[model samples]
Target: MQLNISRGPKATGKTVRLRQTAMKAGIKEKNILIGTSYPDRELEAKVLQLALRGLKVICIDECREEQLAFLRRVKDLICNSVTVHVVVAN
Candidate 1:
């Protein structure tokens, strides 16, 4: 249930940075969810689905500040089983 944030300007390698952090954290590449866009309801569902299926790190790129509540929601629902790594543009 750890929360991590990669914050920088757009095109500043936040996604790559998060992946590196995930690698350092010992989470497998296959177990990491590399988010490609902002969260919608469909993607939100996928997040929870992956969390339930052993997704260790969630790196949501291009995140808006408001989207953090959504991340926290998923973290709470996952109940300390998964780690959340969020990417936010400055």
Candidate 2:
């Protein structure tokens, strides 16, 4: 499953909560990925680790202007899938 998470400052906590729920559901810690619109390679890597461990990745774009493009890419990735969730950042 692909989840597009966007909710300003809440996105971070939302991501964490999703992971927690997934963990409680017995989902392995290797299928979740988290992403962000802001650039932070290190943080991104850490988030990736967390996601790969069992949460969705946190995507953070190095280029702010490329965020939309990233979203488009993500959309493309999920097009062939059966389910998708888009969390818009307010």
Candidate 3:
């Protein structure tokens, strides 16, 4: 199954809760990925690496209007791939 979650600050907890719930329901840690894009390049690399390792990728972007469209494109790419959950957080 695949899921794309978009959210603002309030939804931060929601994402974590969802991941935790999914894990408790039997999802492996390696199969669940969480991340944010506002950090530094090193962090981005780490997130990407983790996602590439076969986990879901949840990218958090805090209300960056210009990035919305770009993120949509990225979502499409992720949906077609075998890896990544591809979440976009505002």
Best by lDDT: 1
What lDDT score goes with residue 59 in model 2?
A: 34
Better of 1 and 3 by lDDT: 1
Residue-pair clash count for candidate 3: 0
Compared with the true structure, the alpha-carbon lDDT of candidate 3 equals 0.46
Candidate 2 Cα errors over 4 Å, as ranges: 1-3, 10-12, 24-26, 34-68, 80-90
lDDT of 3 at 33: 41
How much does each candidate deviate from the true structure in C-alpha RMSD? 3.1, 7.2, 5.5
Q: Which pairs, if any, clash in model 1?
A: none
Q: What tens digits encode model 1's per-residue C-alpha lDDT throughout 1-90? A: 566877866787777887787788776666555454535555567778867888676656566666666666666677575777777656
Evaluate residue 25 in candidate 2 and report its C-alpha lDDT on the 0 to 100 scale.
51
Give the Å error, residue 54, model 1: 1.2
Lowest lDDT 10-residue stretch of candidate 1: 34-43
Q: Report the lDDT of model 2 for residue 9.
A: 58
| TM-score versus the correct structure, for each prediction | 0.65, 0.33, 0.36
What shift in Å separates residue 25 of candidate 2 from its native position after superposition? 6.6
From the highest lDDT down, the ranking of the candidates is 1, 3, 2
